[model samples]
Target: MSRIEARIEDLGLALPAPMLPPGNFKLVNVYGGLAYISGHPAIDGSTVLVQGVVGRDLTVEEGYEAARLAALSIIASLKHELGDLDRVTSWLRAVGYVQSAPEFHDNAKVVNGFSDLIIEIWGEAGRHARSAPGQGPSPLDVPVIIDAIVAISE
Candidate 1:
């Protein structure tokens, strides 16, 4: 296994199967040594693992898990595109959308789920700029959706 894959194993995390876009957009676009990954929900073969709005239907913890799942899907998609996790040099940025009640303001904390996992797997290379915006609702009513930009080596 590649070092990156070994790290994931050490964390007891397996990348989920990469998901195809439900719509017409491409799941990943590579250019200029960077990969732009589309937003992914916490889904596995059309099953939405975590749903509903935070602070209402789910707790902050559940939202965190959902974001983590979404990040895993993103990593899976990356692996599918590059054929190896070791190709990744660094994460550039990530944006997470949180389906939340109006009173739920801890959106950044929710997004940390993704960030934390990335750092855990890639060490310093996984650290990146991030934004977590809370929305009233999302497609399929999932609790979280995440997208990322990563730098990759040839």
Candidate 2:
């Protein structure tokens, strides 16, 4: 197994199957050693494991886990395209959208779930510039959505 995969195993993280795009867009596209992943819902394909607005029905911790799940979905998409996690050179950036109430502004703390998981698996290389925002809703009203960019070595 790749080092990242091994680390994921150690950390009790398993890559979920990449979600098929609900529309015409592709899940991921790679060119020039960069992979751009589409926004991933926090669903596990069966259903959304978490739902509702942050600070209303869900706590920040709950939102964090949801974001982590979204990140895992992106990782699954990456593995689908690249065949091996070890080929990843670095996490370039991430965009996180949170379905949240207007009063809640802790989107960054929620997105840290994904960042922390990446750091656990990729060490320093996984740290990246990130944008997290409170949004009105997502495809399924899921608590979180995430998209990522990763650089890979050929």
TM-score winner: 1
Name the 10 consecutive residues with the lowest summed lDDT in model 2. 41-50
lDDT of 2 by residue, 97-117 (tens): 999999998999999998998
Model 1 poorest 10 in a row by lDDT: 42-51
TM-score of 1: 0.97
For model 1, the superposed segments whose C-alpha errors exceed 4 Å read none
C-alpha lDDT values of all predictions = 0.89, 0.87
Q: What is the TM-score of each candidate against the true structure?
A: 0.97, 0.95
Q: Count clashes in each candidate, considering only residues at least 3 apart in sequence or on different chains.
A: 0, 0
Which residue runs of candidate 2 sit more than 4 Å off their true CA positions? none
Q: Could you give the C-alpha RMSD of every candidate to the true structure, in order shown?
A: 0.9, 1.1
Model 2's TM-score against the true structure: 0.95
The true-versus-predicted C-alpha distance at residue 21 of model 2, in Å, is 1.2
lDDT of 1 by residue, 1-154 (tens): 7899898888898888788789988898999999999989998756777889998998989888988899888888888889988999999999999999999999998899899999988889999999999998699999899988999999
